[model samples]
Target chain A: MAKVLLKGNEAVVRAAIEAGCKYFFGYPITPQNEIPEYFSKELPKIGGAFVQGESEVASINMLYGAAAAGARAMTSSSSPGIALMQEGIGYISKAELPAVIVNMMRGGPGLGGIQPSQSDYHMCVKGGANGDYHNIVLAPGNVQELVDMVQEAFDIADQYGMLVIVLADGLIGQMMEPVELRKPKARPIEPKTWALTGPNGGKPHRIYNLKLQAPDLEQDNIDLFKKYEVIEKNETRYEDYMMDDAEFAFASYGTASRVVRTAVDKLRAEGYKIGLIRPQTLWPFPYEAFKRPNIKKYLDVELSMGQMIDDVAIACGDKNMIEFFGHTGGVLITVDEVCDFAKKIMGGAK
Target chain B: MSRIDRIFCAGFGGQGVMSMGQLLAYAAMLEELEVTWCPSYGPEMRGGEANCSVTISDERIGSPLINNDATVGVFMNGAAYNKFKNKVQPGGKIFMNSDLIEDSNPRTDVTYYKIPVNSIATRLGKIQLANMVMLGALNDQAHLVNQDMLLEAFKKVFGAAKEKYIPINKEALAEGAKAAAEMFK
Candidate 1:
């Protein structure tokens, strides 16, 4: 396959088209505006639909409507916009709707600066609307993964009957890279037996998260928890680099993970045996990978900040082996800082 | 495997610094080496300075960050030179656009090559392609990558519709290369 130069935003839209997705609803936001712009031009060419909704809230609701109608639908927004759509996302999760949402996160607590940031780590994994629900979040580091994960996101959303998120950041969204567009596979146009496709033959099918009856609502929550358990058991993914002979490891995800990978390589070349543990799936968190007896003996934790360290501590048993370093509000932690931390840990200087 | 060569290119936003780094990385990939090209942008990309990093190696690259001692530094503007001059490795080469950079000051330990990239681009009838000219010069001086590989990278980037620009770009590349070779001699 020949490579084509594409920005990260454009790559996601192209991947959506290749994943058999026919509907996209989104509003413009910094660092991710290119996504909606690309979809506006390309979706119509393929007989697909792209709508710039009135707001992120309306956009996510449109996704909900399309997914309920058994169409492959998606929406994208940045940190602030995503926060606005949280209520709608809660509805989609409660209703078990199959849809993909993209969060090209920018730095934020409120109206934060427009720079790439992993500040949304907690929001994406732990803050999906309101109740007891989890959205399968896929974090992509580069444009290639951005393209590949979009397709994978759709499949995961449909198969699990839940909302899926492709998490990226301003850096990944604005960057350009060479990508080969994959040929889309033909999928079944018919909705699943459980989907609310208007009473296929006999009884009318209704889809909604609101079950006023206590017994029915309890059963629904139980069923959703069970599905999450299965996902936890089966779907965690992580990449390990140079860990076999290392005495310490740095853990990071998304764009920060890529930076950690470079730092690890440089440290290795300088004769420091440092390793990197990068999680591709943020929710299930790949706890088992770090829990391995060998890795436990050699692992320390690192994050954009103290956010993901909680997961690391949980995974590594809170043994004080985990160390945290970060600069908040979109400030990038340099490779030198990470190397110094690894050196101190290895040299027993701390 | 030996360490991957990581290069950082920095300049104003419209200088095509990102494109230049990407072309080099892509060319290395065509040579069957592993490569990664990551551009820095955001609010920092609008009218502010922009930069990118390219890592090319015999094995898979773990990350794409360029540390203080990077293998190569290409500065297309005075601001880039001022910001990154101290970061180049002792023996590493610093490529600067002589047309825009009036001051040739750099660390005494590192070798600096000043190429008139903007002037060459003006001569070529397209001033925006100055970045390409600088890339051509760097490719010749470093020989870290092959000319054919660079051309293949350009083909991948520009595609067929813009095929006509190939000859002009190649000419620009060749002119820059020849000028750099002469300066070193």
Candidate 2:
């Protein structure tokens, strides 16, 4: 398809439709509100369903219900709204249901503000709900990447029968850019043999998140962890920009990476061997990408007060020096300021 | 060096700040240049103080934000002018709506064009058309995109239902550009 100017929020819905997402259940929130709004308009035209649930909690449970019925289901929201969906998300993987959730992150611990933020890194990647489970997290840096990732999120969800979350900030959600809505790589469509298409011929399948017995739940957790290991091995993705001989790397993702890329260009022009290590997947964390021995240090940049910095520090380990520069409560950092910060880091680099 | 034009526009909610940024960004995209438009939305927009940043680059745009590196800025109110006056690059240009902003003692390094967008749009009998006038004036001074490409954007935005208003908007744009031609150069 030809390129069309689209907001990051609207692009998510378009990509979901292309990926054969048949049912969307989401409550409204700033920045990401466009996702459900667009879905509500477009999905019905394609003989699909778009339901605005009573609340974010209700919406996610609706998505869970749809996914259990063997339908490609999705729900999208911003910070507080997404936080409300945590229990439902935690419930999905144990039930072995496939669902896609988009959290266009906004500032806060609790309805902070309608500004872009990456503070929910721990919440999304660490499985904020009560469990030993992790959702497959896909972090897209731009609108095109966002489009591709949303489609990929669906495939990854179905392929492994796991929940996949596309983690983008409100900036990425509200920003407008031209994007070609195309599924570049078509993953093999997983057959819905496990779906409960009503007991007409085969044995009935009982699926629920409530694993009451201790050993049964423990075994399920072990199996789920094993599946996560397989996913980590296969689906871990990161992009290294100008990192072949980088002395220092800007470890970031999503909108923060976009600003850092410009800093890389500027700092490179100034003879600073700075590069970018943008993790496309927040989970699986792409620890292998940090094996660049040439990089003397890693500077983790983000819109939050350094949540992802911990992840980068974990990836880099004790050998390399890891520094953090971030803004809290939706205060944005600019390319110029990043360049200034990079210069200071370059001056101090070994 | 790849050209990157970072344009910022600010005003009250209905002052056409968003429209100016959108039109310019759309026109640049039509010209096959990389473009990104980001609005400071939520309370920053709908709560009255609206502002938007548009970046047009020959290369892939890294950040949709301009921050303190705007090559050009358009301000429709005194608050916008005050907030963004020091934000532009040293050699950048600012187009202020003189009719709305009274105290614009612009910085010496960056150039300033005080265009009377409100007065011009008032003359056109469409006060809301200040955004078009401001956009026309800015484009004329900067030559961010050709006149033809911008007209196409106006057409696309106005759509078929409002086809009749295109000519009026085009005239307003031309008038603003003509005003710019007189002031600049």
Candidate 3:
């Protein structure tokens, strides 16, 4: 396929379509409005549903309904909008429905701003609404990876009968880059035997999450965590770069990782043994990457006020070897800043 | 050795700053060079000094940010010029609208070309073509892409606009390129 220029938001829309996603539910939000806008135009042509609900809350529940009926459904929003959808997301997880939710995150504790931000790390990887379930979180750095991850998100969602979240900041949502149309190799999905398609020999097939007894719900939680354990073992993806003999290691994801790569290159070019451990899957967190042999120090890079540092701290488990560098309220951490910080940290200075 | 041209384009909201930077990025993509175009997509873009940063590199781009490392600055208005004039790296180049701004205190370290884009576009019959004229002027001075290749990129980038506007756009590009050659010499 010929490489064509595409904004990241639009590319995710196209990729989801190519992956056989036939339904989209979203509200218009900055930096991510292109996803719904492009899908609204493209999906109807392909005989799919494009519905803009009254708000983000309604939009997410629309996804829940669509996914419950055995349709591949998706919804995208920025930080605050995603926060509104968290209750529905928690419901979807409890119902064991398969859907793809996209968070092209912007700054926020509340309505922060319409710029790129990764401040939703804890909300995404931890609990936002309230639950013990985990969403398969895929953090893609570039437009091409975002394209690929959108396709993979659908597959993973269907495969697990669970929601998969495509995590990108506003930079990936808004930037333009050349991408060739490609779909990941399709995984054989188990038939949705649990879809709400009416009676099976006059017996109602339930897609309900109304476990009344505490023990039953506790058992359900236990079963879900067991599945998550299998996922943690199987789906944990990370990119280990130049870590052969790395003395200084940097851990970042999505946008921050891209900057860290340049900083790593600059440091390596200057005779420093620096490497990067980029967690492509934020939920699975890839704690194994932190268990390296020769890394003396770790730099936790983020677009928030040190949210990912906690994860890095837990991952580096043994030593208090991690230092944090981050920017918040929609400010981006640049390559030069990362370079300077790595040097400062490596110099044994805070 | 390959040179990376990190270009910054800034202007008012309706001045086609994003469009100009995107076209160059598309041109580089067409040439199979690695490129990225990132716009300042916020409230400020709603008429308050809109801008976009572009990077066309021979190697994979790690950070698509020109932040403070822009090698070229193209400003279409005085506000845009003032905001980004100091962002150009030392020994870098700048192209500004001569009709709107006169950088009386221009930097001594880099070359500055005052391109009369609005006047050229006015002469070319459409004032909106100033962005294209500026694009051509930058291409003329930077030699970033060949004229024919840039024309191809224009047709590809604005697929539907080609039939109705390419000829005039071609003229605007040529006039700006010619103007640049005359001025720089």
Best by TM-score: 3
Full-model lDDT for every candidate: 0.81, 0.87, 0.88
Write the residue-wise lDDT of candidate 1 on B1-185 in tens digits: 57568788999988888789888977886777767777776555454898888877887555566768678889999988888877678889899999888764557887888899999999999998798889999988887699877888888877888888888999989988987888967
Better of 1 and 2 by lDDT: 2
Question: Per-residue lDDT of A1-350 in model 3, one digit per residue for the tens?
Answer: 99988999999988999899999999998989999999999999999989999999999999999998899889999999999999999999999888998999998889888889998999988869786888989999899999999998998988887889999999999999999878687787899987888886887777776788999999999999998998899899999888887888999999889889989888988888889999999898888889877888888899998887787888878547988899988888988899999998788431
**For candidate 3, lDDT tens digit of each residue in B59-81?**
88888888777899999999888
Question: Candidates' DockQ values?
Answer: 0.49, 0.77, 0.82
RMSD score of candidate 1 (Å): 2.9
Higher-TM-score candidate among 2 and 3? 3
Error of 1 at A7 (Å): 3.2
Point out where model 2 deviates above 4 Å. A348-350, B44-47
Q: Is candidate 2 or 3 superior in DockQ?
A: 3
Expressed as tens digits, the lDDT of each residue in B1-185 for candidate 2 is 88989998888887878878888888888899999999988854353888899999999888778877899988999988898777788999999999988873558998888899899999999898888888888998988998767778877666788778888888888988988888855
Best-matching candidate per DockQ: 3
Q: What's the iRMSD of model 1?
A: 2.6
Q: Which residue pairs in model 1 clash with each other?
A: A262-B63
Clashes of each: 1, 0, 0
The candidate maximizing lDDT is 3
Displacement of the residue B124 alpha carbon in candidate 2, Å: 2.5
Model 2 accuracy (lDDT, Cα): 0.87
